[model samples]
Target chain A: MRLKLLGLAAAVALLAACSSDQDAAGTGSVTGATSATAPTTNAGAVRPGTRQDFEVNVGDRVFFGFDQYDLSPEARSTLDRQAQWLNQYRAVTIQVEGHADERGTREYNLALGERRANAVKNYLVARGVDPNRVGVISYGKERPAVLGSNEAAWAQNRRGVTVVQ
Target chain B: MTMSAFMTRCDRLARLAVLALAVLVAGAAAARAELRVDITRGTVQPMPIAITDLLGQGQSEGQIGRDISAVVSADLERSGLFKPIDKRAFIQDLVSLQQQPRFADWQVLRAQALVSGTVEPQPDGLVRVAFRLWDVAAQQHLTGFAYRIEPKAWRRVAHKIADQIYERITGEKGYFDSRVVYIAESGPANQRVKRLAVMDQDGENNQFLTDGRSLVLTPRYSPTTEEITYLSFFNNRPRVYLFNLETGRQEVLGDFPGMTFAPRFSPDGNRVLMSMAANGNTEIYAMDLRTRRTQQLTNHPAIDTAPSFSDDGSRIVFESDRGGTQQLYVMGADGSDVKRITFGQGRYANPVWSPRGDLIAFTRLYQGRFYIGVIRPDGTGERLITEAYHVEGPTWAPNGRVLMYFKETPSSDGRSRRARLYSIDLTGQNEREVVTPMDASDPAWSPLIP
Candidate 1:
């Protein structure tokens, strides 16, 4: 019963956080919002949302399979939302960071990470984000989000994160 | 003439002949006084050697003298070629630089060779070190040398003395008088902070070159200069940076539109080879330092990186996945005759050509383990030197006698992974850990400094 109460509290807190995010977007810039093709319904603001908002609402990251850079359907869906959020904030520029698991040579993983980041950038550009606004950087296996050598940690580490600049 | 006169003349001729013979024998003995030991094969058991504490002259007894001797002893010990005998077994104590060692006593202790030296403080605030090598079996002096240097460089002086002895005995160049530049890592597994560090080959005089605010990797030393080319992640943009040790200056290699990494200096240190990615395709590029002009070496759609030049700078070996899985390839300096050099079941990467131009060291991964190996340029006589759970980034010592690489042990609890540096001889023997203050990797040994 205590676990259920805690779950309810967490849901309420999440809803409150999302509503506050929408309120901030609504009061932000209305001019940039007017210029975008489809402004977010809750916010008539044109300014780009915070990186935290993009991560929480639009999904800031996508994962790839082992030694592979091709995007999956789930990854494509995440990129689509990222594109919509990027389009909503016309004035903001973003940098895509590609990372890899610690199973390969440092130099080779560096190249693999580059391919992964560029794959995301290409997908987002096809989904209507400007190519000039999106830059890519690869950290290789140096900055792993997860630390373990297990499959779970490796899967989480092989990801691309988009950050607003 | 009478018979008695004839007998007297014959006796006088005999005396003259004896005198001539004696003079010739004396001259030959003088010429052969300097003993020599021919080392035709590496010893299974290290030859026993005794290095006495170097006596200090006109100074505080044996302070610096003992320190230098300890460094020299440690260097010879780490080489796995010499076993320093205990001083307690010595029958005769070292007293003065001018006195000759009682070779019979060293022979009694079963020492094959003896090293004795003296340190004297000079009037110009420098220390003069003089050492002599003795062959116990021959009971003769083999070689000796003297040098005057600042007291602060005592360790280098010791290394120099050790190198001289090593070369004289082994008939090969010694790598003691060298430095290594590597990436020093610290902190938790997830948030590792790596910095560029330089130190003596035996893990002394360590100094960090970078502040760890930016991540650094794969520092390659120039064969002819005190400069290194490494990859850095400053401002979240990964680029190749060239750092000069003497000048304490750092600069980005080129103004690329995208990321540039995996850098190495040409054999002559005139150019740098690196990989640059654009529009998701990574290719090898070389830049001439004198003209500041860049040239693309590989124009393939597949990734071609980690380009290491041969000693003559005529060819390069690199890793690529153009044929499906990662494999090594050799090509001319002009990017012609690109032939795959690895065709085994596993993937190979980071092919570094030996300074002797005979073998290329590389990292191999197969069946969930990583290996450090060497192969001929023609992909013949492939030999795996060492294996670990995860090993990569093999760099050759200046003499090409040893290869240094990094090994990582995975954390079972997912939070405390450990990495360390290790080295092995080219013959796959004498595998030893190069202890660092913290986790270290990507070691690049500098050529013997002038």
Candidate 2:
């Protein structure tokens, strides 16, 4: 009941915040959700009725290749599941963060990351997810999922992750 | 040349260089290098110099003299144009040199040039500085200057003395009296905290402008003022902001509905050129700094960013993918006569126009490696200056004779990455690292301080 109330408050805030203003208070649930979910990296856990439910069961992130924004077959399969889960949670809107590896220049990587995020948005919208329910941002090479300079880290860093608000 | 070779073969060309120096200091001044490098011959050699401690009356003044002279030596040494002869080999004492520098004594140490100065502390709590630059080989006094400044400005005084020597010897405006602002990076790769940092061009007097509360990137110094314009992720909305160093106040450049980034200042410092990304389309925009009015320079469907202005602010060179790949394009300052400038063998990005208006520096990604290259504005005389696993952000010294960029080096296991700053000349030689306390990137060299 408490989480439901919080979700309702966030949904109201999101609607009142509208499409343009980047109000910091709009993501009340997201700020707490990240800290609670950061420690739960288990892949097999699939509990329902919580924010981690979407992250664990729906798989919030899709990876991309180096300097390549075109979705692969595996990424498409993941987005398909994400779109369904997002549609189910009517009050839960999401902000998709697109990231890139550190190999490219900062400005160019930003543009590349935007293309990736926009691609994911276009894919989810095509799958019948409401366009207004989804927001997009490109962190570029600033935020990395893993801390390494190797191919493994680079592969994980170049990704589009959906954050539930 | 390396240090050992510089010591052994230093005297061979001293006689021939005297005539060249005379012609350079007389008629070809301001457009020529008085140091060892001869651009026409494509040869690089650091001129040998002997720096002596400044004579002083009191103990504190003597301490200041030593500190000031050390800074001057370090400045010349870092330029890769002057090889300061070791002090252990000096035969002339400060007492004798203050009266009359014994040229044969310095010549025995293979010093082609000599610098001597003095420091005087005033009763009013101010300090006075006077310096002399002498051509040791020709036994002639080249330049001398005196300055009176507060004691807190000793580093600046030292830099000014170095600038006088550099200008008199090289026949070009000295870059010593300048500051460099860059991004000071820390934390892990995923959660990096970037702050704005500034220091002297020779890497002294370091200060952090921001406290690392928000992420800042690509800080550019105003060519005409003590202000910087950069992109900030404040409030989770990427926007361009102008920060005044004097007032410690930051103002958003404009209230664009989308991200405003890749910012640079015009040569006149009256406007800022940046990229505004709206929807899925990115284009270049120039905003009047005072009026906050913006004029879109490119109306392309593809990504267009990293816009830089020519010295006169009449033309802008930026990178765009309208040609199906990232390449540099030159357009008029009014967004007219758009023409591509780079036709190289790789994807070109991060195009920065040289301050002299003769060249454009960019990062070329080919296959997997990155190269920092310079190309003429007219799409000719393209040359690669340096290469690395990851190198980007080329900024020019105010004189336009040298360039500074950052290079990221991977750790042995390839799990961690370290980014550091480096400087290189237009001749593709004298590549030196500009050290910082922490990981650094996106360096912006300020104009010579007023």
Local accuracy by lDDT, each model: 0.79, 0.78
Q: Between which residue pairs do clashes occur in model 1?
A: A32-A46, A33-A46
Cα-based lDDT at residue B412, candidate 1: 74
In candidate 1, what are the lDDT values of residues A1-165, reduced to their tens digit?
754666744543443345211322232221222111223442332223765457556766788999999998989998999999899988778888888988888999999999999999999999999999998888788776655667776787787877666
Residue A19, model 2: lDDT of 28
How far off is residue B285 in model 1, in Å?
A: 1.0
Candidates 1 onward: DockQ, in order: 0.32, 0.35
Give the runs in model 2 whose Cα sits over 4 Å from its true position: A1-49, B1-41
Kindly provide the TM-score obtained by chain B of candidate 1 when compared with the true chain B: 0.90
Candidate number with greatest DockQ: 2
Error of 2 at B386 (Å): 0.9
Evaluated at residue B79, the lDDT of candidate 1 is 81
